[model samples]
Target: MVHFMSFLIAFSLIAVSGKASSGFLYPQFYDHSCPRAQAMVKSVVAKAVAKETRMAASLLRLLFHDCFVKGCDASLLLDSSGTITSEKRSNPNRNSARGFEVLDGIKSALEKECPQTVSCADILALAARDSTVLTGGPSWEVPLGRRDSRSASLSGSNNNIPPPNSTFQTLLTKFKLQGLDVVDLVALSGSHTIGDSRCTSFRQRLYNQSGNGQPDNTLDQSYAAQLRPRCPRSGGDQNLFVLDFVSPTKFDNAYYKNILASKGLLNSDQVLLTKNKASMELVNLYFFGGQLSTWPTT
Candidate 1:
């Protein structure tokens, strides 16, 4: 019995040590690595760019689009074959056919390049970065090797994503559920700097601001004017414009600065500045021409 106990104790120590060194154990997405991780990520991202360019002009609009009224649900990824395995209900914002076409092309290329060595989840992450930069956002280093989710849950998609009108707490909860920190949440929301939100999406934020939840009164006059035509009183396009006016096709920190100066379009975007103290600081950092600051780099 004494000998058996000693062996058990030794085995437990090894197991704990292994777990500790692996790191990013929770939320699961962070726990990934590919055979040629960085190279694979780069190659696939380049493919997403090519695919986007090949599609119709309207298709590019769909690819970089976000689900503000519905939250950034990636359900737009599910096809008829994918829907059955998706873990969440499909969001209408995901109806962009071209986005998935690009994704499929990337997947096919990766298969030939590495043969089941990469995960679609990782491809999505890198492709999104490519898409954002292509649309005029800052290109940060993308962490590679995310695992493919075995199943899709439409229910999870609806409950997990944040609404255009979600409160600070709700937004934090969504990020946490996805294994992102509050800082990451603030930064990720910056993606909105280049995209547009439909009038219907921001109508409540504009007219009955309170019911819509987040209310910011500092946007420029002309900005509202440009949006008004599309987002009328009765409800029209809710697609609000992003702050990266110079080049909506490139990813950068311009959106962060916009928030610092009260130029964020979405109520949720402005709320990051007004609602959270730390979030505001981050916005200021970027707004004032600060350096890029998210991990996994991109």
Candidate 2:
């Protein structure tokens, strides 16, 4: 990294201590331990995203999959071993969650800069933040100093990460379990603005949404028609569709607008508008005032 890319992150979490503390994460944990750590991560992520714009969303997804199970300990990054079963094989992550090689590149750089000083958990967090900003999203200071899990939990991964077909209640319940509220759910769902979903992930919405041989009425008929060609009833499970049809590669509030227009690609997404009022208001808040980035940090 000949030229360091500096991003001043004024967002910092309170430091905690003691074994009983709720959190021990700190945004500036690596300031002295590895001064170049964040910059190194940004450099790699910028290059990776440059080669493939979608890589930004993929990297961000890795963080979500990891944190949903075991609280961002990087257990999702582990490989199956003598006594450990990798979370990669979990239903939510199997053949999905990607960007491990990008993390490996980041960890390798951090190790070279300060051997044993950086943790995989921190790397995942930083990489996710960098990926978001690279895709024209807001940049936030991520908490660091977390450790990687010794063992991966396949069952936890499957049960934790909300599926694309989850109802509004299921999605909110999952977020509540994580100490997040409805606003968090709607705001986080906005991340779909930059990602792609496999045909299988949302094929149910295209057809047979309620097992009556009808497509999800919540989805715009035209969008469903566009999806049906590539994603048939039983095949082409791997076909990719931009989650947000309006601005697929940009990280913004278009996802909320899609939900409003009934063009939401996934069942879980449309539910934000149809199933709940608070979330719907948040969606409108973002779509109408999306340019302000008014998402509250609760």
Candidate 3:
């Protein structure tokens, strides 16, 4: 009962409508299966990532938020003003306004192509996977057909997401709760290869530790020295960025390999390799031994 081509027709009209102004097309004219409709979705998402880092970050964040909490419920995609609550966060919600704009872009394109036939939830899932590949993570085909959520909850922060300091056990529990197996956890963590966290988020591992062969200590001694100027005492403007200078913006298994070499960027990342058998096993397979080349195959 989904007409796909109409969605493309709608987007083509928007493209032709000129850059000065564009709005939703007639709902009656929307379709679902059109290749153009899918193309519009891809095109709009790409434009968002190109113009706004926050937009891209938020999309990836939403995917992690959803999968870690409620099995990819797409709950994080809802706007707070839209008659719903959202999950909680240790820090204030860093919801990016640009993220909403990108969502709108997708919604508008879909509306022109298929009216309201496609759900916002589906768009959210697709956007997350699309965002991941854009940021140099593995590409996996996600099945579509998700429905829009009517409400958002601030309480989702409680048990859904893992904090930067979460222990190995806690991280495993969090991911397992989301229906992801150990392999998925290791595979997904590769996301850290891009982006950044605040310096204060992981300074304790550097200044407070008794010399352990930790990557934070080996952080290009020069890089660590430069960070001190910005993070002074691990507070105020200590936010660390997660960009993997070696391969920024290319989806690959390099992140896993970094862990084996003790180049993990965060304490949580390092802990996965050092603590617990299940985690160590996966880390060894992917990071230590380079088994991720055909990961998810087993």
Candidate 4:
């Protein structure tokens, strides 16, 4: 599982933080201007994760959502102004998106070191890599030099991000629209190994998953029962449950294991096993051990 996660995580990062040329981005982009730039990001992220381990996953998720809509451009950070509508107001990010304060700290420190030398988009990438390492996941060399977008995309955020209740095919199509493949989808979804999902995110699985008054059969009955009290059929929407109950604070393959055991918390997760043959196979590959021809390196 560890071996596979190392590969998946690298793919997750590389595939997400992708815009690099024309503008010319690289790992060494900050070498001369602010040599301590990456370290500052790591330090801020380390402290945040230490204070709240879930911050690691939150940072990572923030990176993914930001990059998906605007190609790692930090448009996700924008607030509504004259004509700009903040992505934060979108359905996908509403109450779920977080770690902005930690990001603000990193940005503030970087400005002190060298004003505007590091971009928020690059900070997102570096913090995500740092968060992964802090949470027992692999590291990747993040390409820097991504410029923050001046605009936010509310419609894009609402339409692009795959919702928690997305069917397997819907998830794949959304990923594909972002230039990601089946492999990237599976790899990135493995990030569910850490973090939490709000009751509102997965409440449908607990009751009336298919429009009928019944829980999702793929979700283990016992697990649903445990979730029902705090995550009733209605309300209690903000309550959070660990995505991977086995190692909630660690970035590992336990998420895939939970799916294998029919304990996946969200419909999107459980559908990987119950709805798609290829996705199910990938889940099994990630859960059990597997061989890789070549691993991604820094």
Candidate 5:
């Protein structure tokens, strides 16, 4: 769980105005500066996702991690040099966060078309939006003209991104700090429907969850048994498991349904139902189509 005070600081940073004269994001920031920016980003992302569907989820998660740390300023993309320490080495990102190659490709194409016209920050935002749409999710006009950060924050990355083992209250607190509510939490978590989680992310739930040499009781026994063979107590930390077993490659509400059945892959996910009434209601809303009345609104 992230500290409450840190959350406050994060929100404060996000509230700061950008360097643009208007200090706000708009959909057409690059209309004159670079006309084909959006098309190039979408084309690259589409090709990458078409080659590997999971890349869609990876790109979306990368954007989320970036925004949470430094208000989506592209700090996560910076490589370590002189005074800069890359956030890529942070705990939450080390071996888990990916999709950098796709971003590099987009940046290269944009630079060739119009040098330094497209900021990496806007590229990330566009890539995230395109990834969602490519994966059968919603499409939206991503505001552009975000400036890139000259510095990166490894500590911020480690502290801000919620861990898989976080408590439900802690996860909600993190979301609230970002001006997101239970609805956003449930909605955004649906991204897990398409991604994969490493064994290290959920090993505790498979063995010695409470230091009692027993699997987590909240996890379905059959699922736990199914997970242990590949996710052994000792090794196989890098093995991957689909986050949403029911629809592993789709961006839908099946993730909510999995939580309802105690089949959630991560403790942070299962706690949505066990820890709070509001979250449970939200989960049910998505599960039964009450909240999903307007579908594909990711």
Candidate 6:
């Protein structure tokens, strides 16, 4: 089994052995080692996204979850074996996270082209950017040279990745712990513009949020009414709803627009507007930014 120690060793070697420029990742990390690495990853990611549009969102979320747990080291990709526990079973993952098969396919293709030359960590980062682009989202140059971890962290996965029910301040603190600020939180939350959330993820808001039996007051009553029949108080845990009701598959700022209108899907999402002034301003900025390019780059 791949262990966390192996990841540390790999990262240490790169940092100390001068394999990467002063230990920092760059877009050109694979230029000499495997010239076609990025192209291969993008091709595989494009094919996966074509098969199922939601796969793009799944892949993007997968990278986010991975980065949160272990600094984008691909610890999330390790499978369970012996004493090593897989992060897949963590609270934020389990039935919620996906797109592993897509990663496997990309890894297989890369191995054939250049055996062990590309790390799964870098594959995830590249696939995430490609997935975003394939889904009509913004494109950015991803820094490469991340090494795959040999171990997974179930505790870190659970503790680090914020849940759908997290309060606005809790979510902000969680992002801050990872060295991200309000701008990053709001910008990254724009990913919700393209994905689906399970019924269980938001059902608490529909039936009894705050233990009050009444639905969350922040949720638009009409929208909540529309959701209850399909989501229900029980069963349908796996039933899916678009995170962004409008432009569900398009990677735009519709998520912020929805939140501004009290139509955001999850408690965590709606709280961005309801619970904090800074977050509300970010939401407004993205809602009116009109395009991904216009949103804050910081």
TM-scores of all candidate predictions against the true structure: 0.65, 0.89, 0.73, 0.95, 0.89, 0.89
**Residue pairs with clashing backbones, model 6:** 2-150, 2-151, 3-150, 3-151, 4-151
- How accurate locally, in lDDT, is each candidate? 0.50, 0.78, 0.55, 0.86, 0.80, 0.80
Candidate 2 scores a C-alpha RMSD against the true structure in Å of 5.6
Q: Between which residue pairs do clashes occur in model 5?
A: none
Off by over 4 Å in 4: 20-22, 291-298
lDDT for 117 in candidate 3 is: 71
Better of 2 and 3 by lDDT: 2
Each candidate's clash count: 39, 0, 35, 0, 0, 5
Q: Higher-lDDT candidate among 2 and 5?
A: 5
- lDDT score for candidate 6 against the true structure: 0.80
Scanning candidate 4 in windows of ten residues, the lowest lDDT window is 289-298
Taking the tens digit of each residue's C-alpha lDDT, what string does model 4 give over 45-117? 9999999999999999998888778678999999899989999999999989999999999999999999978
Cα-lDDT of candidate 5: 0.80
Least accurate 10 contiguous residues by lDDT in model 2: 1-10
Model 5 stretches with alpha carbons more than 4 Å out: 1-22, 291-298
Task: Give me the runs in candidate 1 sitting further than 4 Å from their true place.
Answer: 1-89, 96-98, 132-145, 209-221, 238-240, 289-298
Better of 1 and 6 by TM-score: 6
Q: 64 in model 6: Cα distance from truth in Å?
A: 0.5
lDDT of 1 by residue, 191-295 (tens): 554444556655665556554543336565566666666676685453445445544544456666666666566667778878877767666654564444542
Candidate 5's TM-score: 0.89
Q: Provide the RMSD of all predictions against the true structure, rounded to 1 decimal.
A: 12.1, 5.6, 10.2, 3.1, 6.6, 8.0
Clash pairs (backbone) in predicted model 2: none
Candidate 1 vs candidate 3, lDDT winner:
3
Candidate 6 TM-score versus the reference: 0.89
- Judge candidate 4 at residue 206 and give its lDDT: 84
lDDT of 3: 0.55
